[model samples]
Target: MVMTRAANIAFKPEHKITMLCLSSSGQFLSWADQSGSVSLASVGKNHTLDVKGNWHAPGTVVGLCLRGQRAYVLDDVEGLFCVNQQGEVDWHVPVAGGGFSLHEGPTDMAVVDALGRLLRVGYDGSPTDLTSQFEGILKAMYVSEFLVLSFEDGSVKALNGSQVVWNRPVRGEVGESITALGMDASGHLIIGREGYALVDGEEEALEMETWCLNGQGLLFRSDLKTRLTHITPGLGSVVCGFDNGSVTHYKDNQHQELLNTGFAVQSLMVRQNHVVVSSWFYLFGVEEGSEPWKIEHQGMPMLLESSNDGSICFFAGEDQNDWTEPEPIGFFSLKSEARDADPSELTEWFQRPDTEPERSAEEIYRVDETVENLLTEEERMLMEKPPVIGLDSLHAALDDFAFASPDDQAQGTLNVDAESLLDDLDDQLSSMAMMPDEGLFDALNEEVVAPIAPVPAAGEDQVVTCDEDGTAVVLLDGLGSEDPQNRIVMWSWVDSTGQEIATQARAKVRLSAGVHRFELRICDSEGQWSSDTIQLTLK
Candidate 1:
């Protein structure tokens, strides 16, 4: 199904994206590609994005964070760099053993390298090494004046200047890895693993269930069909996206389903009144009292950032290695109509005709009877007849035919010279069994080019009201139509009566208060035609 709202591409990098970061206010976006190229864009009004600057990193970027108009990038080979909006590096610090995570504090930034070293860098780019007491650190987060660390042994510790604030030992069986960790609005640490979570060292099993903690330290749990992949706290409710493609909202000891994407949800973000969900290659935006709108991406959307008032959202991610070219990051305003499908449409979508149904015994017998009735008299006789000769009898018959005299052969049913004809046939068969020429094999192995199908998008349907003149001027758009080779040579718009009205990609026409339909047909260079129809309702 096509997306109801069109998603605008902000910028496309030359290489595949490796990491993406969006600022807390959703005003600045920064991304890095596989080629070590980094770019920063400013999300302007109406969710429009403009690339402000671009720079090249020394190595592959592993982590990225944005603060205001500047970007903090951590690469695998180099340490870190604070870049301004004009592509200028404000400062560069050589991090030992490379970096894993980068977090921005109120005045300084935190960096965790590959060797479990935590360093805090000031605004002037001077990095002070913190304690390295913890080994095999998997993740580190700097919040307020404390550093929270999770280890490979499933242990967690919060430190304040070498002083242990609180520690939680491994809760599950030995070697169980931590899957998610975050701080709620009430300043409570929530740590999630495979089948459960730990709230202040208290075990909460979450198998086949969902849970949420409100701002008042109240915990709520609900039964679920699958495990949760992502959870985001909203204004008065908590939304959770599951591995089964369902997004559920829980609040006031009640739950309601938002939408199901039919694919494993990858990420989620919540704005004031909108919930943005990402699954596979599509992003869904759902708002109160409105159908959810979707925007399809060329790659899986891994990063989602939304504005404070739910007016705009920006998303970006790496390509899934299936496209001929890498996809760009995109931003869209939530005010547009981006509905995907309703409940009935989704039901019809999933019931595909993949295989034929089994036939009943009576139906099978009727099919056999119909086949028998279609056979000719000769075919029926051949089916009833038995083998005419055994193996030894066939050999005797051949021997007799080979040695028969000319007069005896004439008396038999055969008319041709059996011995001479057999000799020639053997010679021809021997020659035919030989291998063919290399050129002939090469011709057989040549690849065949398939015809390219043109995609004709007639744009969205429109609804308008007539002016005092009892007519309205409407614009019919077919610019979204495309051919892969950029070979679209002709565009035609036909009215309901099969009358050609326009021959351009876009046309303006006047109509009265009535319902009208227009069909847009596009022709490619290869003389292939594809068409799409759009409806317009006027009042």
Candidate 2:
């Protein structure tokens, strides 16, 4: 995403910013200062104007959460209060003892009082005594169907709605009361200041090389693989910027690359197809296979948030010669290019002769001859993507396609047994034709129904272990069918977090810990769709 950015002033206040939070709407950023000054900014335009409300609450603002149009804040002396976008105090309630941290759940909010009480609150409602209703819960996070709780001593418990599912003992002895409790990149529970422990998956400290920048006395909010200063979530993979001036790409558990930049990165975020990395004065927009597009920033940005549409981005930082108030630097219209060939794969692509095509011939997109003939010229052009070895390589794959690695090829010895597959496809097709339901044909809207094939079936051990470099490709192979429309004309590959990694049948993915469910939506030529889902667990 190469976006054109502009600089604009957000507000005029010199309060030392302690907490920064972006709203779920992607508009408006609410910040709390050391003096307990809460300000709001509507941040979707070319610039952020001072639409902030006036909140002069005393005492330090310990916790801040913005949901919808209200900002939920907790102050030492002021107590828990809901502030609307207009800066009006919507509701105020005293904290029985004192609250430290605030975590948002799927349906409600959970606050940790000093006495290990979990005070729950609704979106716009006042805080209640949910802590008194529960047992030994200091911090509570209700995720999915599991209620993950962290206690004062760094212990965690997962309860599946009133039933104890799992309990992880205290990670280590703590010298003081728990300061913070939250989840980490691994989907594991973490107790700040005390230590972090993996509650959901097995913990293997895969340490990678990291860097350190001088002067910042901040302890890591979450100490991941390295001293990663910036993080951008990716489909099946994660991009991390380390202090060592290097950008590392990881999938599964394998560390991928060394996009070495001498300057320390402050932020890493994905904009469309590009990964945006920010340094002290530069914002680098990197697309696969091309040099990173660098844009100079006025100064170090304390906070950067872009819209979901990727149309604009706003950063909270001091401009040159001004450290009084956080100015809004907006970048607009970052158009992103859709690249097919993987940038990670370009490391080898460049090693080959310059005259050679960027991708292998086998990578070209292909559909059944029936699909080619049935499609309009425009559809035909779009449908035939490039060099994709979808169905053509099914039989000849053993001889033509070189295995990604020797071990993978050794395991790839098994191919699709086409005979039984065709029989099964025929049987399913016949059954479908005989069924009384006419929904399938009606949806097709075609008088002549060409025989479509079943989606490719998985060979033995369809799920393979992470390769030597920590990448795993789930091959959509061994599947056989004879139905004309059954030829998969399109593919949708989605990761656990709903990020689509690939549109091709085969998915080369980086899986996080625990069970990751991915759904593959395949459409045949006749506008019919079929889905194949798989759950892969990464330790």
Candidate 3:
């Protein structure tokens, strides 16, 4: 099945179902119930439908015929109402008395009513009674330019208005009634009576004299064991569904019995080589070698039709008592969906003559595994590791690390103290040596060594700038001469927890020369910090 079982829809229980019909293209299925309302449900992609009010007939819907988007419904009122796909009434033609039967034509409908009135309906939604020749009620009718009618005489009559063009009295023993009637492609009348022989007209019987008209009105083409309970034409086959739930296919005068369906066959339709049958709750399909699939429904169906896209729609529900309650009506299409199967099992299945083509192996047809998985290994290698940087690019490594984040400024200040402080003057001088061969010495300003520590006037501070490499040069200043130990400090970063990330603590410290928070504290001869501790941040 092309669609899944879960896709089935359930409607409100109280909405009565009157009739159901599908569009010619199978694009939509229009259903109407006792409320005289119709819903044109889309078959594929949904469309914005134009909903109409209520139906004119509150009675049970007897039959329905659709053309373009307009539908003609025959209901209990015995009248014909022209309704759009949305169930809105376009127009109505009330039969003078009551409608009996209706047949479709090229652009109009031929209607026969209970009063034995014959009428021709034009595209304009108007009715013109052509004749009235009824002894009782009109049961069945077939429409063309010329109409054929079965009357109380157990005879078939071809009529052109009130005048009879020709009449063929059915040759039968007695008591049997006309079961089915239709016209073949050659315009010869085909009738099925309650007796034995299957008959052909005078001209057609010449080649096949085996099939002759009998007194019981049953015509048999041959003495062979073949029974045709109901017959309908197909493109290349004649479909005759039997009473035993078996649909027989006849092609070139040969017959093939299909699956022994357990349900009574109600109707048969043929559109080419495809055969569509509507039995009790089951729908059957027969192709070449595949098993017949029976799609079962919950209600009894009254009509079946196939769409051009190969989907079928049928009417099923409560046909007798309550026509108001809508039943479950469904659409079915033949399509294959992907399923998971083992490779070897799938190969064996495809090798079987009856199985459909293997869609999962389509990629294997173009290339083998060696060519298909070419880029897999290379892609895995690329995903395994981060990109590598050369050792000479150590500064690039530091650039990747988040040093002094902007979020660390929430706290007050950061302080640092060293356990061992180098007091060698030469070591202090070496700290100012420039490594010009490397990029680290780019920010060195050696000229500031002469006035390393300067006494400042009261309330004076100094400003220092760092190079593009984030290295800052610090000089001790703003201390009185009474303080012998001059200290240079830089405050780099303070985290949210008041922890110092990196700070400079020395008389003259290189401190790896990066951004840091510094605190310069000058101790006087009494070993006291000048005034109070001061803090600054190096770039």
Candidate 4:
């Protein structure tokens, strides 16, 4: 099955998770718990972040919303404080009455206290009383620049700048709380619950399991299945996640069942063809096709959130009564990462088919992370890009060998002593087969071009001394593998008398001696020569 289960992360045991929500920028999932502990996690990367600062509250965190890197939080004691990504509290506002929920807007948040005070808390660090227009708020929805507040008395008011612009009585009972409030693309408010309809006028009551506006008409669930724990509006569709272990997707009023995991489906989200859900102890998803997939997990699924366009998803699970940090889960794209990926990010994927093609650090369609190894960037370039041989990058063999430093060139003149060792090697090579070449050369510093080494005349042995051969033959592999720069422009042979014998690699010598000395030299393309001296003793 499809999975992005890269790794596991554990947290301190003191945290008791209460609520889960996405950051204002949708890049991270931030949640709070009973112990005043707040944590932010990167979704696609599967990591629980220990934000570099500390957040301390006198009581449990009641409600919070993350936008950008700042976390605007509310505590049980009617306290409102703003904490940034680094865990530093930017400001704190103490209210007279206890507050319950916090709804975030583009630039600020509207909070309702137990004393029925509808105050706007954000910006200047002080709560601005929004004229107490609604009380006992059942639910609040932020659309564009307007704050839509639904009160327990079944009164729905659309307020702009704390001033009521429109008021309407909802369809449910006076004390019934609104489960969902949403706005269509054209800015028309759609209220859902006992009976779903638009506030504009009379419309057919919707059979929506969960609803969302697709800019066209009411999009709702059709084939009702099991008990739903969560539902959300997706692009051009509505998605419902049921506790009956089923995820249903609806488009054009037709519903299709994607998959049924026998476990409790805690959360469900749909973005285009991508569907992400948390069920039982695992996070599962269906993207790009009808194939259902599962991700491995270490804890129970607790919270989930997704990008508006459905490119990636973030979910976390906490082990029952195990105070450690929750296992952060998310949907990874196969096309490219979210449009605003971090610079240091190494991978990108796409789930939405219609999404415009965007360049990524690495564009990988699918990665079988378990079995297939991840290729480095250089390896990928070598595998994907065309060969440099026939392309514009072609170069000569000599071009590859770089010029040595002046100091290195000066040190190149030093010679290696191969005296006795050369004699022993020559004796052995005298029994081996060899190849030959012929060339005429000037003395040591001859500007004339050099010929290749001479071929073995009749066999390996070349009698250097006419009366008695020093070894069997003179075999010169002097340059050997010592041509580090591949710049051995010429090789020279010298005798024990310090006179150049021949300007070739190997030659025969007539010597009358008890001991004799000889030298073999090599030159680089830079015209610098280095020599080795070998001594042979004849008894």
Best by lDDT: 1
Candidate 2 residue-pair clash tally = 28
TM-score, per-candidate, Cα-based = 0.56, 0.45, 0.50, 0.49
**Per-residue alpha-carbon lDDT of model 3 for 1-539, expressed as tens digits?**
32111113323325655566667787656667756555655555432223333345655465577777777876546477787755577888777645656777665677765444566786578665555554322335543445666553346666655456655555544323444554433334455444322443311111110111222332333322323445665545355666578776655555578655667777776654556677775556665554555444455554565566454444455433332335555444443322333333422311234446666666657656565466687786886668777654654644533334446544542221222223444677798997476444644644454323423222223344666655443443333333233432222322222222222221222222333333333332232333223344454
Instruction: State the lDDT at 312 in candidate 1.
Output: 63
Candidate 3 TM-score, true structure as reference: 0.50
- How well does candidate 1 score on lDDT at residue 76? 64
Clashes of 1: 1
Candidate 1 residue pairs in clash (backbone atoms < 3 Å): 293-338
TM-score of 4: 0.49
Better of 1 and 3 by TM-score: 1
lDDT of 2: 0.55
Off by over 4 Å in 4: 1-7, 10-14, 20-29, 39-50, 114-117, 126-129, 172-177, 183-190, 195-231, 242-246, 260-265, 306-313, 322-539
lDDT rank order? 1, 4, 2, 3
Of 1 and 3, the candidate ranking higher by lDDT: 1
What's the best-to-worst order under TM-score? 1, 3, 4, 2
Kindly report which residue stretches of model 2 are placed more than 4 angstroms away from their true locations once superposed.
Answer: 1-12, 43-45, 48-52, 113-117, 126-164, 169-232, 241-246, 258-268, 277-285, 293-299, 318-333, 336-539
How much lDDT does each candidate structure score?
0.70, 0.55, 0.49, 0.56
